[model samples]
Target: MIGRLNHVAIAVGDIAKASAVYRDTLGAEVSAPVAQTEHGVTTVFITLPNTKIELLEPLGADSPIAKFLERNADGGIHHVCYEVDDILAARDKLIADGARVLGGGEPKIGAHGKPVLFLHPKDFCGTLVELEQA
Candidate 1:
Protein backbone atom coordinates (compact mmCIF):
# COMPACT_ATOMS: atom_id res chain seq x y z
CA MET A 1 0.00 0.00 0.00
CA ILE A 2 1.07 3.58 -0.53
CA GLY A 3 2.35 5.72 2.31
CA ARG A 4 2.89 9.45 2.42
CA LEU A 5 3.51 11.62 -0.61
CA ASN A 6 7.19 11.45 -1.52
CA HIS A 7 7.58 14.09 -4.19
CA VAL A 8 5.88 15.52 -7.22
CA ALA A 9 8.02 15.39 -10.35
CA ILE A 10 7.99 18.04 -13.04
CA ALA A 11 9.41 17.59 -16.51
CA VAL A 12 11.45 20.58 -17.63
CA GLY A 13 13.46 21.46 -20.71
CA ASP A 14 16.18 22.96 -18.56
CA ILE A 15 16.75 21.96 -14.96
CA ALA A 16 18.86 25.06 -14.24
CA LYS A 17 16.11 27.47 -15.27
CA ALA A 18 13.47 25.52 -13.37
CA SER A 19 15.65 25.41 -10.26
CA ALA A 20 16.12 29.16 -10.44
CA VAL A 21 12.37 29.73 -10.59
CA TYR A 22 11.99 27.75 -7.39
CA ARG A 23 15.14 28.99 -5.74
CA ASP A 24 15.32 32.67 -6.76
CA THR A 25 11.75 33.64 -7.59
CA LEU A 26 9.86 31.39 -5.20
CA GLY A 27 12.49 31.50 -2.44
CA ALA A 28 12.58 27.74 -2.06
CA GLU A 29 15.41 25.48 -0.92
CA VAL A 30 16.58 23.76 -4.06
CA SER A 31 19.30 21.19 -4.31
CA ALA A 32 22.07 21.00 -6.87
CA PRO A 33 21.45 19.04 -10.03
CA VAL A 34 22.34 15.36 -9.86
CA ALA A 35 22.36 13.14 -12.90
CA GLN A 36 20.46 9.90 -12.66
CA THR A 37 22.01 8.02 -15.55
CA GLU A 38 20.00 4.89 -15.10
CA HIS A 39 16.77 6.85 -15.02
CA GLY A 40 17.97 9.09 -17.85
CA VAL A 41 17.27 12.34 -16.01
CA THR A 42 19.07 15.20 -14.31
CA THR A 43 17.23 16.04 -11.08
CA VAL A 44 16.94 19.08 -8.85
CA PHE A 45 14.85 18.78 -5.73
CA ILE A 46 13.07 21.69 -4.10
CA THR A 47 12.57 20.76 -0.48
CA LEU A 48 9.33 21.73 1.22
CA PRO A 49 7.69 21.37 4.60
CA ASN A 50 5.57 18.34 3.73
CA THR A 51 7.25 16.99 0.60
CA LYS A 52 9.59 17.84 -2.28
CA ILE A 53 9.27 18.97 -5.85
CA GLU A 54 11.54 17.20 -8.33
CA LEU A 55 12.64 18.98 -11.47
CA LEU A 56 13.66 16.58 -14.23
CA GLU A 57 15.62 17.33 -17.38
CA PRO A 58 16.22 14.76 -20.06
CA LEU A 59 19.66 13.23 -19.83
CA GLY A 60 19.88 12.29 -23.50
CA ALA A 61 17.93 12.11 -26.73
CA ASP A 62 16.74 8.64 -25.84
CA SER A 63 15.62 9.67 -22.39
CA PRO A 64 11.94 9.16 -21.58
CA ILE A 65 11.77 12.72 -20.34
CA ALA A 66 12.87 13.79 -23.81
CA LYS A 67 9.81 12.10 -25.27
CA PHE A 68 7.62 13.60 -22.59
CA LEU A 69 8.93 17.07 -23.41
CA GLU A 70 8.29 16.44 -27.08
CA ARG A 71 4.63 15.86 -26.33
CA ASN A 72 4.51 18.70 -23.79
CA ALA A 73 6.73 21.38 -25.26
CA ASP A 74 6.67 23.70 -22.25
CA GLY A 75 6.88 20.80 -19.79
CA GLY A 76 4.56 20.15 -16.87
CA ILE A 77 3.79 17.74 -14.06
CA HIS A 78 5.56 14.48 -14.83
CA HIS A 79 4.51 12.19 -12.01
CA VAL A 80 3.63 12.01 -8.35
CA CYS A 81 5.58 9.69 -6.06
CA TYR A 82 4.21 8.05 -2.95
CA GLU A 83 6.18 6.14 -0.39
CA VAL A 84 5.45 2.51 0.37
CA ASP A 85 6.52 0.35 3.25
CA ASP A 86 6.64 -2.77 1.13
CA ILE A 87 6.98 -2.04 -2.55
CA LEU A 88 6.98 -5.64 -3.70
CA ALA A 89 3.83 -6.36 -1.76
CA ALA A 90 2.21 -3.25 -3.08
CA ARG A 91 3.18 -4.26 -6.61
CA ASP A 92 1.64 -7.68 -6.17
CA LYS A 93 -1.56 -6.26 -4.76
CA LEU A 94 -1.77 -3.69 -7.50
CA ILE A 95 -1.22 -6.38 -10.07
CA ALA A 96 -3.89 -8.63 -8.58
CA ASP A 97 -6.23 -5.67 -8.61
CA GLY A 98 -5.61 -5.35 -12.37
CA ALA A 99 -3.46 -2.27 -12.13
CA ARG A 100 -0.72 -1.97 -14.71
CA VAL A 101 2.84 -1.42 -13.56
CA LEU A 102 5.34 0.18 -15.84
CA GLY A 103 8.83 -1.13 -16.71
CA GLY A 104 7.83 -4.77 -16.76
CA GLY A 105 6.65 -4.56 -13.15
CA GLU A 106 10.16 -4.30 -11.79
CA PRO A 107 11.46 -1.95 -9.18
CA LYS A 108 14.22 0.45 -10.17
CA ILE A 109 16.46 2.65 -8.08
CA GLY A 110 14.89 6.10 -8.03
CA ALA A 111 16.25 9.62 -7.69
CA HIS A 112 16.25 9.23 -3.93
CA GLY A 113 18.35 6.07 -4.31
CA LYS A 114 15.36 4.02 -3.18
CA PRO A 115 13.58 1.17 -4.92
CA VAL A 116 10.66 2.52 -6.96
CA LEU A 117 7.99 1.48 -9.39
CA PHE A 118 5.77 3.47 -11.76
CA LEU A 119 2.15 2.58 -12.35
CA HIS A 120 0.08 3.22 -15.42
CA PRO A 121 -1.45 6.66 -15.52
CA LYS A 122 -4.84 5.51 -16.75
CA ASP A 123 -5.33 3.40 -13.65
CA PHE A 124 -4.77 6.34 -11.36
CA CYS A 125 -6.95 9.20 -12.56
CA GLY A 126 -4.82 9.97 -15.60
CA THR A 127 -1.84 10.83 -13.45
CA LEU A 128 1.37 8.83 -13.41
CA VAL A 129 1.92 7.33 -10.00
CA GLU A 130 5.35 6.35 -8.69
CA LEU A 131 5.69 4.15 -5.66
CA GLU A 132 8.93 4.50 -3.70
CA GLN A 133 10.17 2.26 -0.94
CA ALA A 134 10.04 3.90 2.45
Candidate 2:
Protein backbone atom coordinates (compact mmCIF):
# COMPACT_ATOMS: atom_id res chain seq x y z
CA MET A 1 0.00 0.00 0.00
CA ILE A 2 1.01 3.60 -0.51
CA GLY A 3 2.52 5.55 2.32
CA ARG A 4 2.94 9.32 2.50
CA LEU A 5 3.46 11.32 -0.64
CA ASN A 6 7.18 11.81 -1.20
CA HIS A 7 9.09 14.45 -3.12
CA VAL A 8 8.12 16.01 -6.38
CA ALA A 9 10.83 15.56 -9.02
CA ILE A 10 11.85 18.51 -11.16
CA ALA A 11 14.05 18.40 -14.23
CA VAL A 12 16.66 21.14 -14.65
CA GLY A 13 19.30 22.07 -17.18
CA ASP A 14 21.77 22.72 -14.37
CA ILE A 15 21.42 21.07 -10.99
CA ALA A 16 23.76 23.53 -9.26
CA LYS A 17 21.87 26.56 -10.53
CA ALA A 18 18.59 25.03 -9.47
CA SER A 19 20.01 24.21 -6.06
CA ALA A 20 21.22 27.78 -5.57
CA VAL A 21 17.81 29.14 -6.42
CA TYR A 22 16.00 26.72 -4.18
CA ARG A 23 18.43 27.07 -1.31
CA ASP A 24 19.67 30.68 -1.42
CA THR A 25 16.64 32.36 -2.94
CA LEU A 26 13.84 30.26 -1.60
CA GLY A 27 15.56 29.67 1.77
CA ALA A 28 15.37 25.93 1.59
CA GLU A 29 18.20 23.87 3.04
CA VAL A 30 19.59 21.61 0.35
CA SER A 31 21.40 18.35 0.72
CA ALA A 32 24.65 17.61 -1.09
CA PRO A 33 23.96 16.56 -4.65
CA VAL A 34 23.82 12.83 -5.22
CA ALA A 35 24.53 11.03 -8.46
CA GLN A 36 22.22 8.21 -9.48
CA THR A 37 24.16 6.49 -12.24
CA GLU A 38 21.69 3.72 -12.83
CA HIS A 39 18.96 6.22 -13.48
CA GLY A 40 21.36 8.25 -15.62
CA VAL A 41 21.09 11.47 -13.66
CA THR A 42 22.30 13.53 -10.70
CA THR A 43 20.08 15.17 -8.14
CA VAL A 44 19.99 17.41 -5.09
CA PHE A 45 17.47 16.97 -2.34
CA ILE A 46 15.78 19.78 -0.41
CA THR A 47 14.59 18.20 2.77
CA LEU A 48 11.26 18.85 4.41
CA PRO A 49 9.44 17.24 7.29
CA ASN A 50 6.91 15.20 5.35
CA THR A 51 8.58 15.19 1.94
CA LYS A 52 11.47 16.55 -0.10
CA ILE A 53 12.00 18.29 -3.43
CA GLU A 54 14.42 16.71 -5.88
CA LEU A 55 16.23 18.64 -8.61
CA LEU A 56 17.29 16.38 -11.44
CA GLU A 57 19.88 16.90 -14.21
CA PRO A 58 20.83 14.44 -16.87
CA LEU A 59 24.33 13.00 -16.56
CA GLY A 60 24.76 12.27 -20.26
CA ALA A 61 23.09 12.52 -23.65
CA ASP A 62 21.80 8.97 -23.49
CA SER A 63 20.12 9.53 -20.19
CA PRO A 64 16.36 9.28 -20.03
CA ILE A 65 16.36 12.50 -18.01
CA ALA A 66 17.99 14.23 -20.96
CA LYS A 67 15.28 12.97 -23.28
CA PHE A 68 12.70 14.20 -20.82
CA LEU A 69 14.12 17.71 -20.96
CA GLU A 70 14.29 17.62 -24.73
CA ARG A 71 10.74 16.36 -25.07
CA ASN A 72 9.37 19.02 -22.78
CA ALA A 73 11.64 21.75 -24.20
CA ASP A 74 11.70 23.36 -20.78
CA GLY A 75 13.09 22.20 -17.45
CA GLY A 76 10.18 21.84 -15.05
CA ILE A 77 8.25 19.46 -12.90
CA HIS A 78 8.96 15.94 -14.00
CA HIS A 79 6.90 13.63 -11.79
CA VAL A 80 5.21 13.11 -8.46
CA CYS A 81 6.48 10.24 -6.29
CA TYR A 82 4.38 8.49 -3.71
CA GLU A 83 6.01 6.44 -0.97
CA VAL A 84 4.91 2.82 -0.75
CA ASP A 85 5.33 0.11 1.83
CA ASP A 86 5.82 -2.73 -0.60
CA ILE A 87 7.02 -1.95 -4.10
CA LEU A 88 6.74 -5.46 -5.55
CA ALA A 89 3.18 -5.90 -4.44
CA ALA A 90 2.29 -2.39 -5.53
CA ARG A 91 3.71 -3.02 -8.97
CA ASP A 92 1.88 -6.32 -9.24
CA LYS A 93 -1.45 -4.79 -8.29
CA LEU A 94 -0.97 -1.86 -10.64
CA ILE A 95 -0.12 -4.19 -13.47
CA ALA A 96 -3.12 -6.36 -12.72
CA ASP A 97 -5.32 -3.26 -12.81
CA GLY A 98 -4.01 -2.49 -16.31
CA ALA A 99 -1.53 0.23 -15.45
CA ARG A 100 1.31 0.55 -17.92
CA VAL A 101 4.71 0.73 -16.25
CA LEU A 102 7.53 2.46 -18.04
CA GLY A 103 10.03 -0.31 -17.51
CA GLY A 104 7.46 -2.98 -16.65
CA GLY A 105 9.56 -4.33 -13.78
CA GLU A 106 10.66 -3.99 -10.20
CA PRO A 107 11.54 -0.74 -8.46
CA LYS A 108 15.15 0.31 -8.72
CA ILE A 109 17.38 2.72 -6.84
CA GLY A 110 16.61 6.29 -7.77
CA ALA A 111 17.36 9.75 -6.43
CA HIS A 112 17.40 10.25 -2.66
CA GLY A 113 18.48 6.69 -1.98
CA LYS A 114 15.11 5.11 -2.57
CA PRO A 115 13.88 2.33 -4.82
CA VAL A 116 11.71 3.88 -7.50
CA LEU A 117 9.68 2.99 -10.55
CA PHE A 118 7.93 5.17 -13.09
CA LEU A 119 4.47 4.40 -14.33
CA HIS A 120 3.57 5.55 -17.82
CA PRO A 121 1.88 8.91 -17.97
CA LYS A 122 -0.59 7.45 -20.38
CA ASP A 123 -1.92 5.36 -17.52
CA PHE A 124 -2.49 8.33 -15.24
CA CYS A 125 -4.34 10.83 -17.40
CA GLY A 126 -1.08 12.29 -18.71
CA THR A 127 0.43 12.76 -15.28
CA LEU A 128 3.60 10.77 -14.78
CA VAL A 129 3.38 8.55 -11.73
CA GLU A 130 6.30 7.47 -9.53
CA LEU A 131 6.22 4.67 -7.01
CA GLU A 132 8.94 4.79 -4.36
CA GLN A 133 10.04 2.62 -1.46
CA ALA A 134 11.64 4.52 1.35
Candidate 3:
Protein backbone atom coordinates (compact mmCIF):
# COMPACT_ATOMS: atom_id res chain seq x y z
CA MET A 1 0.00 0.00 0.00
CA ILE A 2 1.01 3.62 -0.43
CA GLY A 3 2.54 5.56 2.42
CA ARG A 4 3.38 9.25 2.50
CA LEU A 5 3.07 11.61 -0.41
CA ASN A 6 6.58 11.59 -1.80
CA HIS A 7 6.52 14.40 -4.34
CA VAL A 8 4.46 16.15 -6.98
CA ALA A 9 6.02 16.21 -10.42
CA ILE A 10 5.50 18.93 -13.00
CA ALA A 11 6.58 18.65 -16.57
CA VAL A 12 8.27 21.86 -17.70
CA GLY A 13 9.64 23.15 -20.92
CA ASP A 14 12.48 24.82 -19.03
CA ILE A 15 13.61 23.20 -15.82
CA ALA A 16 15.90 26.11 -14.95
CA LYS A 17 13.04 28.55 -15.09
CA ALA A 18 10.79 26.25 -13.12
CA SER A 19 13.46 25.64 -10.51
CA ALA A 20 14.11 29.37 -10.30
CA VAL A 21 10.46 30.06 -9.58
CA TYR A 22 10.52 27.65 -6.67
CA ARG A 23 13.95 28.73 -5.51
CA ASP A 24 14.26 32.47 -6.03
CA THR A 25 10.63 33.46 -6.18
CA LEU A 26 9.24 31.10 -3.56
CA GLY A 27 12.40 30.92 -1.44
CA ALA A 28 12.49 27.14 -1.49
CA GLU A 29 15.58 24.97 -1.48
CA VAL A 30 16.08 23.72 -5.02
CA SER A 31 18.50 21.09 -6.16
CA ALA A 32 20.61 21.36 -9.28
CA PRO A 33 19.22 19.72 -12.36
CA VAL A 34 20.33 16.17 -13.03
CA ALA A 35 19.84 14.43 -16.33
CA GLN A 36 18.20 11.03 -16.20
CA THR A 37 19.12 9.50 -19.53
CA GLU A 38 17.26 6.25 -19.01
CA HIS A 39 14.06 8.11 -18.31
CA GLY A 40 14.85 10.71 -20.96
CA VAL A 41 14.40 13.63 -18.61
CA THR A 42 16.30 16.28 -16.74
CA THR A 43 15.04 16.58 -13.17
CA VAL A 44 15.20 19.18 -10.45
CA PHE A 45 13.85 18.66 -6.94
CA ILE A 46 12.51 21.46 -4.77
CA THR A 47 12.72 20.55 -1.10
CA LEU A 48 9.89 21.54 1.17
CA PRO A 49 8.85 21.03 4.77
CA ASN A 50 6.46 18.13 4.20
CA THR A 51 7.12 16.90 0.68
CA LYS A 52 8.92 17.92 -2.49
CA ILE A 53 8.24 19.31 -5.96
CA GLU A 54 9.87 17.69 -8.96
CA LEU A 55 10.52 19.58 -12.20
CA LEU A 56 10.84 17.41 -15.27
CA GLU A 57 12.20 18.59 -18.62
CA PRO A 58 12.28 16.52 -21.73
CA LEU A 59 15.71 15.15 -22.61
CA GLY A 60 14.97 14.31 -26.23
CA ALA A 61 12.32 14.39 -28.89
CA ASP A 62 11.22 10.86 -28.20
CA SER A 63 11.00 11.44 -24.48
CA PRO A 64 7.62 10.83 -22.90
CA ILE A 65 7.84 14.27 -21.37
CA ALA A 66 8.21 15.64 -24.89
CA LYS A 67 4.95 13.99 -25.84
CA PHE A 68 3.33 15.40 -22.74
CA LEU A 69 4.59 18.86 -23.62
CA GLU A 70 3.02 18.52 -27.05
CA ARG A 71 -0.32 17.80 -25.46
CA ASN A 72 0.13 20.54 -22.88
CA ALA A 73 1.82 23.49 -24.49
CA ASP A 74 2.71 25.15 -21.20
CA GLY A 75 3.54 21.91 -19.40
CA GLY A 76 1.72 20.90 -16.26
CA ILE A 77 1.41 18.45 -13.40
CA HIS A 78 2.83 15.22 -14.72
CA HIS A 79 2.42 12.83 -11.82
CA VAL A 80 2.26 12.38 -8.09
CA CYS A 81 4.52 9.98 -6.27
CA TYR A 82 3.75 8.10 -3.09
CA GLU A 83 6.08 6.09 -0.94
CA VAL A 84 5.52 2.35 -0.59
CA ASP A 85 6.99 -0.23 1.73
CA ASP A 86 7.56 -2.78 -1.00
CA ILE A 87 7.29 -2.02 -4.70
CA LEU A 88 6.88 -5.60 -5.89
CA ALA A 89 4.18 -6.31 -3.35
CA ALA A 90 2.39 -3.09 -4.25
CA ARG A 91 2.59 -3.90 -7.95
CA ASP A 92 1.23 -7.40 -7.44
CA LYS A 93 -1.58 -6.23 -5.23
CA LEU A 94 -2.54 -3.43 -7.59
CA ILE A 95 -2.52 -5.82 -10.54
CA ALA A 96 -4.71 -8.29 -8.69
CA ASP A 97 -7.09 -5.47 -7.89
CA GLY A 98 -7.37 -4.60 -11.63
CA ALA A 99 -5.05 -1.60 -11.84
CA ARG A 100 -2.68 -1.17 -14.75
CA VAL A 101 0.98 -0.57 -14.15
CA LEU A 102 2.88 1.22 -16.84
CA GLY A 103 6.28 0.27 -18.26
CA GLY A 104 5.52 -3.43 -18.36
CA GLY A 105 5.01 -3.67 -14.60
CA GLU A 106 8.74 -3.43 -13.96
CA PRO A 107 10.29 -1.04 -11.51
CA LYS A 108 12.86 1.45 -12.74
CA ILE A 109 15.45 3.47 -10.86
CA GLY A 110 13.94 6.85 -10.24
CA ALA A 111 15.57 10.24 -9.71
CA HIS A 112 15.77 9.49 -6.00
CA GLY A 113 17.77 6.37 -6.80
CA LYS A 114 14.93 4.13 -5.64
CA PRO A 115 12.73 1.64 -7.40
CA VAL A 116 9.68 3.33 -8.93
CA LEU A 117 6.68 2.27 -10.96
CA PHE A 118 4.10 4.37 -12.80
CA LEU A 119 0.43 3.50 -12.67
CA HIS A 120 -2.00 4.15 -15.49
CA PRO A 121 -3.75 7.51 -15.25
CA LYS A 122 -7.17 6.12 -16.14
CA ASP A 123 -7.02 3.75 -13.19
CA PHE A 124 -6.42 6.58 -10.73
CA CYS A 125 -8.96 9.29 -11.59
CA GLY A 126 -7.05 10.86 -14.47
CA THR A 127 -3.91 11.29 -12.44
CA LEU A 128 -0.75 9.43 -13.22
CA VAL A 129 0.50 7.88 -10.00
CA GLU A 130 4.01 6.82 -9.19
CA LEU A 131 4.95 4.40 -6.45
CA GLU A 132 8.42 4.74 -5.03
CA GLN A 133 10.08 2.18 -2.77
CA ALA A 134 10.29 3.48 0.75
- RMSD of every prediction: 0.9, 1.7, 1.1
**Number of the top-ranking candidate, with TM-score as the measure:** 1
Q: Is candidate 2 or candidate 3 better by lDDT?
A: 3
Greater-TM-score candidate between 1 and 2: 1
lDDT of 3 by residue, 1-134 (tens): 68999999999999988888989899999999999888899999888999999999999667888878989988899999999999999999999999999989999988788999999999999999999998
Candidates sorted by lDDT, best first: 3, 1, 2
lDDT of each: 0.93, 0.84, 0.93
Please give each candidate's TM-score. 0.96, 0.88, 0.95
lDDT value, residue 75 of candidate 2: 92
For model 1, residues 47-89, the per-residue Cα lDDT tens digits are: 9999999999999667888888999999999999999999999
Candidate 3's C-alpha runs over 4 A off are none
On TM-score, who's better, 2 or 3? 3
Q: Lowest summed-lDDT stretch of 10 residues in model 2?
A: 104-113
